[model samples]
Target: MEFSPRTAIVTGSDSGIGRATAVALAEAGMDVGITWHSDRAGAEHTAEQVRAAGRKAAIRQLDTTVIPGCAAVIDELAEELGGLDVFVNNAGAGDGVGFLELDHTIWARTMDINLNGAFACIQAAARRMVAAGNGGRIIAVTSVHETQPKVHAAAYVSAKHGLGGLIKTIALELAPHGITANSVAPGAISTPMSGQDGDDPEPTLYPGIPLGRSGRATEIAAVIAFLALPASSYVTGASWAADGGMLQMGPVGSAHLDSSNWRQG
Candidate 1:
């Protein structure tokens, strides 16, 4: 419940949602472990932000696509931080190839990073939590495509859908151990991934989103921080849609459209 001095590991924390979540957890009085795949500088910057918040920061280079090594980093970071109370599986990759052009290699690569890697890290983190005899929190940063289909992102959509199910299963299995697993689904966030930069920009009004704009990384992080609290103990196996009400419309919102132009690049 009280997260003061608790430690958390956030995978792919060099930027985007992971970075925001790490900083937020630090601000909430938890020491944080930050991992990066390519951007060591970004990871260091994130660590700096965490330290600036007056929390301990551990930095590591983690390529989630690596098998045993991916999970091993979780253990290493936990040991370095003394222990772990929270794990955020935020590392993922995707491509825009159409389903018809989707090959086995691309599909495998996407699954390897987005689904398999996440599973490895979650297993490692949960094992540590159980072994320590302390309840913990497991959060995954999924996407709106987890529930909705996109035009040319078959691999990404499939992986996110699998991740959603995986979190639910983990929640069920870990409940007895006082560990909770859940996911935060973001949509059109203003991050580098979505081709946005700098401060949280004003969202452009869109017909599909009730909120009329994209979301901010900090907005999603706020939800993750809440889920990590002792107050959210009962909120396991849930997928919180932080998508500005985008999912609320689904196909019905666009079914009446007369043009295929919406799918154009």
Candidate 2:
């Protein structure tokens, strides 16, 4: 519980929520290791922001589907940063194909990126934390789909759900080492993954969300940053939903539905 983290690593920090989280952790006085999949420039941008916040920033290329190689990237970054006190598993992707049309290749890729890769990478980080004998924090960036089902996103939903469960199991297994594991589930956010710029989510009017708008990447970052801090030491094995009340729409949506057309999605 007495945590003074000096270094942190965030996967998929090249953009969106990952980028925001790296910056937030840096602002919290922790050196940050940032990883990118395809966008080296975006990763560099995040590093710059980290440096601007007066924290050391290390950049690495991470392809989560690359199995042991991706796990190696996490270790490499931790080494470069001197040590790892916080690890955020934020690298993930979703295939929007319907279940009827989903293929094994796509399903496997989704599982590898969002679940399998996370398992490997988080395990690697946890090993370092255990060996260092420093109480650490492990946070996963899951989605609201981790709890709710999406119409055309069976693979994605399942993978997020798996990641969420993995965090809970980790919380139980790592507690003896003083390592707390948790997850943050976000609703529709304005990010590249959501086909919108990762800027202002306030102007985007979304009637489905109770807040009447999409969420900003920074909003979710704030929650993740809190989990990585000593203030959250007592919290573990928990999933925090940063959605704009989107998860609470099931009953409301059903009550207001004009017809059965909603079943098509």
Candidate 3:
């Protein structure tokens, strides 16, 4: 119960990592505000779990992609929570498109939803924390694309790389306020985004991932929970990769392998 009596707002709490994170926080004794963009049922289910854990829970509709008014929503939500102490911006999407084949519309929407929306949420949350004049935690759920790039995932890779850089920048700006900002970059998490086998999604994608398997949503949630804990006070502007050691796999095989056969980057 590191954050007992504290309030946390988790975006996209209906399912996946977000739902798991809400439950994890509740289990640690924090009041949780769960938001879902499209899954009201899942949100209610998470709320029930929160209550079952003996913690206060609330549900709300949140679309991080909607700007301007998102700031109002943050203010109102803070009021509802009776004051905010932590924020986890876990709502994001992935876009698969080749750079040349991607249309401007797809590119623009991808940037808006994945990067801009998160930027707005962080800004709103930081504003509230600054006003409160107390230390707080801000976490962003990014992807392995935070440092590695996927060939056909131009928009997603670009946005994730940008979001990670944005976290570093925001950390510098917020550190003076006693607020810490960090990102959890998960590699191949087995979420609805990757487990889908329809034509729209490439199910077998990234089989080359050295992890040899995709990660579960709860696995990623546990990492986020660690960052939200009070014990992580000294950490800021750091991105902890939760990718099962996949990111360490170089193109020429492991660094332990013979890279003498390859040219330098």
Cα lDDT tens digits for candidate 2, 51-101:
999999999998888897977898899999999999999999988888999
Every model's TM-score: 0.95, 0.97, 0.87
Question: Candidate 1 regions off by >4 Å?
Answer: 1-5, 199-202, 256-258
| Candidate 3 Cα errors over 4 Å, as ranges | 1-5, 196-211, 252-265
> Ranking under lDDT, best-scoring first?
2, 1, 3
How do the residues 90-207 of candidate 1 rate in per-residue lDDT, one tens digit apiece? 9997888888888999888888889988889989999999898788999999998889888788888999999999999989999888899999999888887877765355555666
Best by TM-score: 2
- Sequence-dependent TM-score of model 1: 0.95
Error of 3 at 161 (Å): 1.1
| CA-lDDT, candidates in order | 0.88, 0.93, 0.80
**What TM-score does model 3 achieve against the real structure?**
0.87
Report the poorest 10 consecutive residues by lDDT, candidate 2. 195-204
Using lDDT as the measure, name the better of candidate 1 and candidate 3.
Answer: 1
Clashes of 1: 1
- State the displacement of the C-alpha of residue 248, model 2, in Å, after optimal TM-score superposition: 1.1
